[model samples]
Target: MPYYENAIKKMLPKTYLRQHVAHEIYVALTHFQSLVPMMDKYVYNDGTMKNLMSLTGTIPVMFEDNTYNIPVCLWIEESYPQTAPICYVRPTCEMTVLSGKYISSNGEVMLPYLEEWKNGECDLVSLLQVMVVVFGDFPPVYMHSHPEPEQAPCWLQFHRQAEVLSRTDGSLYLHLASEDDLPFQQENETSC
Candidate 1:
């Protein structure tokens, strides 16, 4: 708790316009312990870079019959509450981003809640809840299919043998020619 308080407090100086920013962040962190506060450089599509406070972690998304932790990064600008925060689905190496109505190919997330964010009405906690619900309906990522393990090629040699079945004792026997003892010839098969 102390760590969170210190981190959130240090995120913005006291002179920052929003005085409730730290408290809102603290409450959000309290509810969502999976998220951790950090300061990182955010690069815009226009190549503009700015140091911003972001929460990087996974949000629980219920998909199918199981729950998946979808990695995400939420960047809160200094004018937060007044402006909507930028959110992105940060998929892991084992996951691939799924582009849809709510998520872009680059993993950017767009939700009605975010688009209609109201300073007094909206907060981080509810934003996460909305994300969870939206993501559950339309998953933002899918697990990458790992290649199957290499298997040793099985070489089976088929020989043309004559089988004799005796009706007297119901006995079966096979007879093969001497030429059948030679190794099998490799087939010239080609794949495009």
Candidate 2:
């Protein structure tokens, strides 16, 4: 009937004394929070007693042939550091497979970056960057079938993924020249 969440994060093995040994879970969660501050924090039956991985927003992948706004999930276990948090790529029905054996239909990703994670020595950010980069190297294929051709967004929307944009806080949109062919420029406003 009520809800409570753990203040810290850790992807460690299931054990009895996990609560007593909280490490970079807090740091990792907070760090991810800082990067995706606007994204909603998801809790999977999360409670102070039973902490689960938190999910944020979609990591939009604009491949040359297709587009994928891959939703990401982060979870800390009882055996963290020695075992890195598993990264799940939640794909939508719109996505179609292209290539990559590590990826699965259940959204499970067997990435080498996570496989080679060294606790205390590695950070989640670096792992995330690696995942994104690897995704670029072996991206999944998406169907080009548009349900509503007239209602589709501009072509630029399907090609707006960048390292710079990924680091910036808040939501961003791809604004291209419309029929009027006006130059893309921000107004005098100080905020996005």
Number of the top-ranking candidate, with lDDT as the measure: 1
Q: Model 2 over residues 83-155: C-alpha lDDT tens digits?
A: 7765666545555554467677656677877777876677666676676667776774455576555443556
What are the models' TM-scores? 0.72, 0.48
Top TM-score hit: 1
Candidate 2's displacement at residue 139, Å, is: 1.3
Candidate 2 shows a clash count of: 10
For each of the candidates, give the backbone clash count.
Answer: 0, 10
Provide the lDDT at 116 for model 1. Answer: 96
Q: Tell me how far the alpha carbon of residue 92 in candidate 2 is from the true structure, in angstroms, after superposition.
A: 2.3
lDDT of 2 at 4: 13
